[model samples]
Every structure is written in C-alpha cells, then in structure tokens.
Target: MLKNKNLIMIFREIKVGELVDFVNTVFYKNANIVPITPQRAISQANNPYAQPNDVALVLALNNKEEIIGFIGILPGKTMLTDERFFWNTCWWIDPEKGKIAAMPLFYSMLKITKSNLIFFDLTPHTASIVAKMGFMTNSITGTKVFLRFNLNQILPKKYAFLAILKPILKFFDSCLNTMFAKKSAKKELNYQVIKCFDASMEVFLSKFKPTMLTPFDNTFFTWISNYSWLTTQPNEFETAIAKKYYFSYITQSFVVELLKITHQNEFIGIVVVTCRDSEMKIPYCFFDDNATEKVLEAIFNYAYNKKITTITTFHPKIKEQLKLKKNTVLFTKQLVKHVGYPKQFETLGITNKLFQDGEGDAVFT
Candidate 1:
C-alpha cells in the first residue's frame, strides 16, 4: 500500500478469500445497486490475461483502510492476431473525495499493464475526460437499430406527444413488420437456430475472419461461456426477483443464440446474438458475401419470433444495410477508445478491425 497525503492506494490481485466482501462493498452495498456475488467475482477473476493472484482492481482507501473507490479490469485476447488487451470497466470514485482522486488510480493501471488498454461504450462526457487523459478515440462508430417503438413507454410522462403519438407509432410499426415479413419471404434461406456453445461453434468461428472486432475462436468463446461472470447461476435473491418481475428484471445470466446456416448440408453462415430484455445484439456474423441479405433476413425473422423489439449490430455493412430500410430506427451511436502501450493499430495490422456491441462487458446488461 502506497500513501498519498491522507489517502492510501492498494495495488494487488484479487484473492478468493476477500472476494465476497470486496464484491458486496464495491458493487452491492447501496440498496439501489445490484451486488455481484462471490461466484461472479471468481469467474471474472479467471481472466486469461491475468497473472497468478492478480485481481485486476485498483482500490483507493482512506487512512482508516476503508475502500473509497475502485476500478475494474477485464483482460482479453484477439483471436486472429493473437494480441492481448485489457478493458477498463466499472469505474467509481467517492463523491466526497472529488474526481481528482481518480487520476492516481487511472495512472496506476497504465503503469501496471503491459498490454494495450481499451474503453468501450463511452458517453460523450466520459469520452471528453478520457481524451484529455491521453486516451485516443477510435474513428469507428457503433450502430443500433430499433425494430419496434413504444412512444408512451419509452418517453417521460411530461412529454404529452408520447401519449398523442403512441397509436400512430404502433400503426407504423405494424406496417413495418409486414414489410419485413415480405422481405424475409423473398429470401428462401435454410438455417437452424441453436442455443448451444460447443465444438461445432468452434468450427464455425474458425472460418470467420475478424477485421476490427475481437476474434471469436474456440478459446475465446470457451472463456466467454465457461468463465464469464455473466454465466453464473443466480443467487436466491436474484431468483426471487426474476420470478416476480420476469421480463422486467435485469437478467442475471448471459443469453446467447447461435444461428447455424446451412443449405444442402453445407455450412454457409453463422450468426451469434446476445439478448437483454427486448434488445438483441449481434456480436458475430460471418457468411458468404452473397448471403448477407439472406442472413440478415433470417436474423430479423428470429428476432420477430422471439418478440425482440430491437436488433442492433456494430458491423459497418450491416448498419448500412439496416439504414436503407425505411422503418429501422437509429438507437444510439457508440464510441470506443484506447490507451497505454501498443497504441499504433497500424503496426498490429488491425487498422480496419471492427468492434461489435457485445464485446467486453457490453453483453452483460
């Protein structure tokens, strides 16, 4: 532990013994906050990039040794290029200490990690701060598409236009659905959607070429499925909440759907989707160039069948295709940024790489 005036900073890997208390105090103590359980902590700590006994956290403590702030670290590896990187997630600092206190912790992370560091899904305000802190933002922007629009449900009560426009939006959405159905019908594609992550998925992903996105190889996918914190079993409290609220409650476990496309017993494409509530996000989609439209149509068909109100993607081609449709709504534009060593992406030969919405902790709502 290093002392700075009245405050002390502790840099250490997370330990199994302190995992429970650490998770509760850092993520769950507030009544409004949902706490991470010991199981989730253990899984998150099992990062492939983590050194032995590394907890991937920077804890700020007062003179009394009570935690005042913390920043989470997630280690990841690129599949095709075999490049390793660290993603910074879940940053929080005590309001009483002021934002200035966060600088030391941020600097600590940069000093410690040998691999490149990335920050995903940054708000404009946070992006501005990170830019000033020496992190460079990527030129690539994320894409989102809404398949359904609920004016009154999404808008605040103060907006009278929501109530007035709800019926109109509903009618328009109905017509849009009909148009989508027509488009899907025109494309006679044969594919089967499965909810399993297995060797077959490994085989399919092996054929995929990741340009700018994180590689989804067997090892990475296995890590995501077997060791990701989002895969843990929900505790009793979470189970009760899920039982009571069902569709309304935040999901405790990650939900993934793999669409395996085949025609005449030959593999043609694969689409992997992650879902949170009414939104479905495509993290990986690889198909023959000729099959893009058909694969997209199949994805929409699945989303409509599952009652998903929104379908989003980060692939530039998919975004362009979705934009061509009259009914698709733009949800939000996402920005990704990076810092630390290995700053030159051109040297790494991943200048054209594409990032997806489901990368890092984004898949976990």
Candidate 2:
C-alpha cells in the first residue's frame, strides 16, 4: 500500500514465478483492466534468462480492488555493464479513473528497479514525461518502406470515412501492383528456416557477439524465438481474455521466425523477421558489413514471397541501401524511435548507437 497526498493505493508487484498463475486465476475473470495477457505472462514465466524473483509487473488498485494502473518490466542483462537491468515494456493508467495513480505507479517501478531501467518505443507524450524524470532520451533512425500499397489497411484506421473506400483502394492496389509486377518478382535465394539454433549458427554468432552492444547469446535468441508475446492463432479463451487487455494481445496474424541466409552455398546473414498482419520488422539482423547489399536483397525477396506490405528496419547500412533501391518499394517513410535510459548510464559510457532496432522488449512484441 502507498499513500500520496492522502490518496491511498494498493500496489501488487508480480514476480516472474507468479506471473502465469496470477494472470490465469485472478486476472482472467476480473479483467476489466489488465496489465498483461495470459500468453504474454506465460512467455515471461518461461523466459530462461529471467530469474524467478525478478519483479515483472506492478499493479495499482483502488479501494474497490479494480486495477487502474500498471508498469511492466522485462529483466535483462546488459552486456556492456554485465549487470541486471529491467526493460520497461508497458505502462498504463486510465486517464479518468487512475489519473492520480500515475506518478505513484512510476515511483513504484523506480523503487523496484532501483532506477536501472531502459525505455524504448516511446510516444511523444511519454518521451516528455520520462525526460522530466531524469532519463536521457535518445533516438534511432529507421525507415518503413512499403512494398505493397496498403492504404486500404492503413488509412481506414485513421479516417473512419475511408472504410467504405477500401474496395476502391484495393482495386487501385491491384492495378498498380500489376503494372509494377516485375519490380516485386521473387528471386530464389538459399535460406533455411530453423526453429532453434544449431551448432554452426552459434559458432557464427560467437564471433560477432563481443562487438554487439547487448551481446545476446544463443540461449537468449532461442527463448525469444520460441516464446512469443503475440500469436497468429488464438483459442476461444484467449480471444475472450483479449477484450479486457489494452495492449496488443491478438492480431490478424503474427509470426516470428529465424532465417539463415546463404549465398554461393555459404552462410551470409541471419535475421529475425517479425510479421504482424501486413507489416514486417527486422528486429535482430546480423551480417558482415560487406554482405549488407546481399542480405537486404534476401530480405526483400522474402518480403515479396510472404506478401508483406511494409518492412521496417533501423540498421544504418540496411536503411542506406533501401534508399538506393527506392524503385523497388512503393514509398518510404522516415521514422524516429525514441529510447530512454537512466541518467547513470552516461557514466557507463552508453550511447544511442549501442542499441539495435529490436532493443528493449520490442522483439517480443
């Protein structure tokens, strides 16, 4: 329980071990407001790198025992510091019902993490708030290149009146795509889809790990690839639970896959492709600097074959190469992704470039 200016709020810190049971038993039935979904909670519980006692979520409840505020944490080990740090995944407070609890919820998280927290993919409002709390806000440049016209899927979400025009928009897409057919033609590339890492892949990554900002290992990637927060398929119970959850618990389709790309019968690059509905993101990609062009060509081919609408990437070389291949895509938008870290990280010499596009909990989502 916490008291702020005579306002009393009950806060519950859910540790890693308790996440699954808490969501399944208490949260499922009384989930008018939810901190995490059942599948996500299970995935967090199954994380091999996380400790059992690490606090994963903090919830604020009022006198009526209704959850009004929450902050989610994903425990991680920073390679540069070799110390424990928490990734701030999700934080929410109902504007009308939990306005007063917002600060308190943040304070609770700070106390639990002892200020060792990393925040990324922030909205403008959230970036402003975190800046005031002594966090250094930094940004990474990325691009979302549209391979196929998806105005029918994209515009309707922002302008409801356009929903009726979807048929026409789709018709336009069909005609335009037919005209640009040769540009998107799929090329055969030697690639292997693996559920888990093999010995050869582990050896290849070991050489590159030391130079990486986070230096995640095979075990970490295995956990990430196997236990995903989002799903392409959901059962009836999961569908029912999603209605009460605020975050992305369900989607039209979702899949995370590891692609081992080879050229001339030799391995060239490895990438993690995350597909949600029509969009695709290369969360984690590793390749030799010289192989950037080939790797991108492989990615474009994969996107074409999969019918991905757009591809988002933050790798500097990949983004630069995309600029050269502008004709291959319908359009491209520059994106600035903001990230926040405790000010103390400055003393550790951490910089904006140290982070990948898939930093924080972004890969899982």
Top TM-score hit: 2
Per-residue lDDT of model 2, residues 1-365, tens digit only:
87767567898889999988887775547767878877788889987758999999988888778888989998877766867788899999988778878888888888888998889899988989899999999888999998877778888889999999999988987787777633554457667677888888888887776556675666878777777788668898788777878888777777888889888888988888998887999988888989998889888888877888899999888999999988778788999988889887878767633577777788877
TM-scores for all candidates: the values are 0.73, 0.92
lDDT of each structure? 0.59, 0.83
Give model 1's clash tally. 6
Prediction RMSDs, each to the true structure: 5.8, 2.3
Which segments of model 2 are wrong by more than 4 Å? Answer: 3-7, 160-169, 181-186
Q: Can you list the residue pairs that collide in candidate 1?
A: 13-55, 14-55, 211-353, 212-353, 212-354, 213-354
**Pairs in clash, predicted candidate 2:** none
Worst 10 residues of 1 by lDDT: 244-253
